[model samples]
Target chain A: MKYLPLIWAGIWRKRSRAILMLLQIASAFVLFGVLQGLDTGVSQTIAKQHGDRLYVSSSVAMGDPLPIGLLARIQSVPGIEYVTPRADFDGSYQKLDQFVPVVAGDVDSFFKVYEELKTSPAAIRALRNDRSGAIVGILTMRKYGWRIGDHIVLTSGLPTSNGSHDWGFDIVGTYDTPDQPTSATALITNFTYLNESRLTGRDHADMFVTKIDSAADADRIGLAIDNAFANSSNETHTQSEAELAAAQLQQLGDLDFIVHGIIGAVFFAVLFATGALMMQSLRERVPELAVLKTVGFTDRRVMALILAESVTFCLVAAGIGLALSTLLLPLARQQIGFSRVPDIVFAEGAACAVVLAFVSGWIPASRGSRLQVVDALAGR
Target chain B: MSFLDQTFALTATALRSMSGRRGAALVTVIGVTTVVGVLISLLALSNGARALGGSEASPDEAVVLGSGAASSQQSVLTRDEALAVRNAPGIKRAPDGTLYLSATTMVSVDAIRSNGKRGSVALVGFTPAIRLFAPGVKLIAGRMYRPGVHELIVSDPLRKMYRGLELGDHITLRGTEWTVVGIAAGNGTVNDSILRADADTVMSAFGRNTYQQVIVELTSPAAFDTFKSWALSNPALPVQVKTEAADFDDTFGQLHRLLDFVAYFIGGVMASGAICGALNSLYASVDARRRELATLRAIGFGGGPIIASVLIEGMLLALPGAFLGAAAAWLLFNGHVLSTEGLIFTLTVTPGLLVVSVSWALAMGLIGASLPALRAARVPVAVALRAT
Candidate 1:
């Protein structure tokens, strides 16, 4: 085609500009990649906890713990198979920077209720036999460099002073979760180890995790549990596990809006900048455009050439940005931890980049093609 | 040959040339403006957040978390413990001999956002000393709430984030509805997001009979060692004493860091697109000006002046964009309330932010124009003259 030389010459003439365009595209892709990665991480965390389970706690909020005595009352209710009570022990290792999750639960009931935690038989037996035994998530163990038999002393941030200052516990086993956010950060200890110990208060349990016999009656079962404790001193709030997690995220407040706004603003900046550049480039080639027009080139051909160039530039930049983003994501994860950034990501937003480029390119390309051949020739 | 004459000549040439290539110049300005606008807006947010997150409390003011409590809200102290803390040494006395002590508790609430979206909001119960510690809290809408009444005074940010937060609107806290009687403004601090109510009302509603943390204004900052030693050594009551500013940092440091990372990360990505736009436009400008540049060179318009002219043209385009972006940001976000967890803050676009944004536009222009300017200057006069 006659346009092939024009394309080659156009690109060859502005080598630096072309190279910069590619770099920019690559960088944008990287940014898009990271944002998608973070979104994926959040979604994954939420997805990990989704199951046929329901949570029962104080109606006020998730932080408000329900009484331990409500477990048996729930077990007796119809469509409820088993009830496992877990106490939230808010303590940390040495410093506040290091997270130490001490979840107190009856080992047998917890194991029966949730089969996600995979541990050794001997370790489970040892945990059951010992009074102050604990099973740490595999990721937690790896983070702290703790062995199976290591005796860890966790300092309490929650008030509890019964001659046991720094609570000592023997690590019995390292367990893994089904989908891996289980070890994102948290250490699970036995309920008896906490309940029998003087650490727990009279009426405090982080919440109760219950398994219903019928999946269909989850909402009904939640309502029934709430109804049971409706008039009590501490009213109960019950919802499916998904709802509970969603409610907790809702507590994060306007994060989605903030994120959406930021994304919109960033995209606006990208479009404005890129559109301006493409428009200027098309306009500057007025003489070349006029020559093409005089040689029987249609306005459509002129538009296509400019649009193609714009798309080529954006696609090059996007590809480079994405390549860099993928390479750097692993390093970022290692530095920040999996809790902050996940391993997997989605590239669905690339569609957004393509659309942005097309629209931006079209605007200037149209303006350039619409220029009169006579006026364009006069510029020379 | 005079410096001013040369500068004037340069300006004339730059303006005339830019006018000739008005279409290209406009594009360059648009691109640079966007880059500058976004960069400046983020900086403003970062500045606003930092200013608010910092402890405006007096240097002598100290807070006490429970023996094991890492967070200020998680610490629980009993009535007896509060009394003991009041009697402790190093507590500054008022003219009336009252100890400058305030006990507070914080609870995060699930709230509805302005867009009818659900969000987290924190509620705080504070004694009268909360006013003493934070003087920036000014009642803008209604009167300061009565001490014993179950009335609440919300910050402006909260008022913006949550719907139905106007005066006389009832908001439920700890399962009990409290009437909003006033709207207060904190100096853009973290407290701007809280719903402030009577201490007893919060305590009773949450069944937290025990106080979360005891804050006491010390006699002097120098007495911190003595005060800390005495408070920690107290066998009767175990508590940890830390500066108000340090405590604020501890509470929201990770959050601020996370936000900063997000801003920079997004900005960096967007900047890449902007940079590409700049390069393309500048390269085209240089190519189109070959004849004009050759004439200028023939007339002793040195390569330096020509390059400077091009850079000035780029900056001219970019600086306007910075202001435009700032104007847009101000119109969109200024005075707008946004919530996170239980805290709220208004998105502020200050004058300083505008300056930063404009400067960033200038930077984008300069960077974008440099390569093209260099290439234009490097063009052989004879070759350029024959370009047409």
Candidate 2:
């Protein structure tokens, strides 16, 4: 504890070299913080998702349309709270760049199944009464400067029974999910309106979302639901929200391999740089280290001091980098749809910094401790 | 000495004494190698994506889509509209006088990957003239799928990637069984990840009466404007017309742009860190020669020569790292196949990428050596000489 000043002095003995090394290590940590933060943040969000919600889709493929007739059968499964049919279509409003995803479903049961989406009861009633009325997500509503009672026409890929590509909807209300703003980008409308109008895939839904009664019975209930449709034409595979999200992410192809590869390359270069710098500085301070040994500092104490310097240097640099990433995460929040960098990233970064310091400083610290006073004083 | 001569002399001296500071110099070499290796490898990935879109695109072909459709997948053209586009002016005619026009639509079919994971692949329905429109697409195995038959020809890359795509394998979609009749090579373009079948057969099986898009080969690249104007001016056809180049760009631009952004962002951060390492190493190199530099300054050597010499040494140090890194990246990742959003591309380490790696390495060397060079040039001759 009393030797902190000595270690600090050793680090700053050449201020320019120290500062440059700090910046180098700090930039590596910046990448570490951002990438690791993104990875952990996504996994944590998936883990914290409502385990009681299950998505039932075609067992054959992900996007294959499932029959809405199966909705009744799924609802009759044991431990089911609420079931709603969902079908999403792509639409563009006014400009091709302004993309709006429309989710066609029963709003009454849909909102009940997805309780996180907050909306006024009056708005839900209005959406139910008006067949052609639509409830826009708060984010999408704000993007196009939409208001209630405004008639907006969207061009969809799917053609209607009347052979028109454009579909008009009266804006009934806006819904938002505070915890996840990106989820608030969907425009919700009645499935019956869509089903009766669209030319293809009528009476079919993309999936059936259900809320289960208990988290522990989710797998059992999902199995029961799948069992009923086991031999049917449109066989269903039910998955909890977490499992579904994980599978979808997995389809993006092994992000762990990429993140690990990049971080490995970064640490490899930094490790060499740190080791070289420590050795270079230690060589220049040999005479001084010998003088310290003569002044009654133990050989072990000298080793500890060198190790202490590297640890403090790496930890401080990593801390700054992690802090920088934390500040920059909000800018990525909109793009990646994550709330923030997870706190676990900082802990992980600190742990990595300690290992980095220990490995890089090992040889230099050992050489300093094993130095003979007679050879060191003689400038050998 | 002349400034040029002085610079040469100073560089020679620094290079000669580099062995004394082997550890520091190694740091710079390793740092630059890592930076350039990472940069080149990622750039190669984006290059592969560009190749995916650019390989089969030609300026002498045009795409017609339903008006206001954001993408071909969304566009819907009726039989009349498709016929009208076939008779449009400026379309190329084969020797048999048949127009080189094809109308196509696609249905998304999920295929099990070789690893037992689900991957969505497109099953495209093409008109008979598709062979004329895309002559670059040719059979690699078995025979071409006959029109009016429920047969599929899967792209070679897709056959290797997904199961149930081999020749003679039957794939059932929505209760209809379709046989795979052939394997085709799509010239490393977007078509490499799709299955092809007859337009009429696919439409009937999928209950679709409309074609999504119509593509026509123009007589010449200059004829594109004429074809576009004719398609847009006619009231009978509510369609959008774009040259094949523009269509490809619009289809694959987002993926390429994202890949480029990620490559450069990661490359930039890594380069900055590597430059810092170079700077520290160069500083140590100069510090090791403080007494010698002071003696040279005392003998009337100009500051410019010292700066130029340090910069030269830095670049020289970084050059080998560049080649080594590029070689590593090429050996490890070049020709590696990756699929994104159902499109397959090979990682290409082209000669142009070598130029990119070398330039980045030299820049790191120059920027890293600047401050250290100044410190060396402005060394206090009397003080340095007296202290050391």
Candidate 3:
């Protein structure tokens, strides 16, 4: 504790050199914090507690169109709480580049199954009363500047019985999810309207989702639902909600490996730079270290001071980098689907900083300690 | 000596001194390597996507899709509507009165990946006219699938990415078994990601009542405008017409743009760190040679020569890392097959990507050298000489 000022002064002996190394180490941590934060957030999204929720899609492929009749059969299965048929009705707004993701289902059962989606009962009733009424999400509303009671026309690839590709709806209400804001981008409508009005793909749904009262029975109940139509032409692939999300995220091409690859290369390079700079700075301090030795500073004590200097420098740099990352994280919220940097990433950054400091500073510190006072004083 | 001569002599002298400062020089080299390697790896990915999107796109070919459809998956065209497109004017006609057109439909099928995870791949069915529309597609193994039978010919990449896709294997979808008859290689287009089969058979088996889109080869590139007006003339055919290139753009341009954005953003952050590292090393090196440079200045050498020499040394040190980094990325990732968003593609490290790597590395080297170069030119000769 008494040598604190001495170590601090050693780190800043040459202001320009120290500052350059500081910037170098800090920039590496910036990449580390951002990448690891985003990576951890993605894993958290996959690791969200969806144990009680179960998804049933076609065994052949997702979006393979299961019959609506299967929805009732699955609902009748034992231990099921609520079930809703989900169908995607993505459309293009005024411009072809603008895509509006609309989900069609029995709004009453759908909202009950997906309790995270917040909306008023009036909107549900309106969607039921008017087949063309749609409940748009708040994010979608803000994006297109839409107001309730506004009539909007969206063009879809699916054709109506009249051979028209246009689907018009009256915006009845707005909805949002606080926990996961990205889910708030969906536009919800009643399933009956889309199924009955579509020209060819009628009486079918993309998938079915059901919730169980207790998470303990989730796997057994999911299997029972799949068993109901195991050998039928429309076989189902049942999975827990979390498993489904993980599979979807995996479809983005082994994200963990990519993130780790880039991070690994960055660290490898940073490690070499830190080591070289430590050695260079230590070489310049031989005479001062010899003077300390002549004044009866133990060899071990000299080594500790060198190590302390590195620890202080690297940790301070990492702290600055992580602080900046937390501030800039929100800008990437939409892309990475994470609003905040996870706490574990900050902890991991600090651990990395310590390890880097120790490894890079070890040889230089030992060399400084092992120097002969007489030889070092002679400028050897 | 002239200014240029002085610059050359000083640079040579600095190069001679670089051996003593090998550690600092090594740090700069390694810093540049990481920045360039990562940048090129990502650029290579985006470049591969761009290559796939634009490769083999003929200006004379036109794609017709339902007006509201964003991609082929969302498009739907009834049989009569598709026939109307092929019957329109400006379509190339053979001597036997056949039109150069192919109506296609797609169905997503579940498959197990090599890693034993559930994945999906596209099975697309094209009419007999497909041979004319895509003349470059060829069977790499086995034979072409026979029409009116449940047979599929998988693309090379598709077969490599998923299991149970080998030739002679049977795949069951919806209680129907389809035999894999051949392995095909495409001309770096969307078809490379999909398996091909008979259009009518796929539609009937998948319970699809409509063709997703119709692709036609025009008599000339100029014929696209004529075909567009003709297809939109009747309200019965509510379809959109675009040159094949534009259609490819609509299908994949956004994804490529996204890849490029990610590459540049990550590369920029890493380059900033690499610049800091190079700067620190150059500073150390300049300090090491402070006495030597001061004595030269005291004698007669101008600051201009010293500055120019330092900058050259920095770039020269960085030059090898640019090649090594690009070479490393190429060796590790080039021609690697991967999939994202249900679209399979190969990572191709092109010559153009090498150019990107060198430019970024050299830029980092130059920016890192600037401040150090300036400080070296301004060293106080009298003070430095009298010290120590």
Evaluation by TM-score, superior candidate among 1 and 2:
2
The docking category that best describes candidate 2 is medium
Model 1, span B1-388: residue lDDT tens? 6445654686576677666666656656665555555555565566556666653656887888777767775666766777788777888887877778888776666566777765666678888766655464688888877677778888876787678788889876545778889998666787777888768777777666667788888889987778888888878676778988787777776666766775666666666567666767777778877787788778777777777877876777677888887887787677665555565555677787777777777877888888888987888989888876
If scored against the real structure, what TM-score would every candidate get?
Answer: 0.87, 0.95, 0.97
Q: Where does candidate 2 stray beyond 4 Å?
A: A215-233
Predicted candidate 3 versus true structure: per-residue lDDT over A205-323, tens digit per residue: 99998888888998898889888898888999988888888888878887788889998998899889989889988988999999999999999999988999999999999998888
Which window of 10 residues has the lowest lDDT sum in candidate 3 chain A?
Answer: A332-341
Q: What share of the true interface contacts does candidate 1 keep?
A: 0.56
DockQ for each numbered candidate: 0.47, 0.54, 0.77
Which 10-residue window in model 1 chain A sums to the lowest lDDT? A335-344
User: lDDT of all predictions, in order shown?
Assistant: 0.71, 0.87, 0.87
Error (Å) of candidate 2 at residue B223 is 2.6
- How far off is model 1, as Cα RMSD? 4.1
Better of 2 and 3 by DockQ: 3
Best candidate, TM-score: 3
In candidate 2, what are the lDDT values of residues B230-316, reduced to their tens digit?
A: 988997677889988888887788778988887888889888999999998998889889999999998999999999999999999
Ranking according to TM-score, highest score first: 3, 2, 1
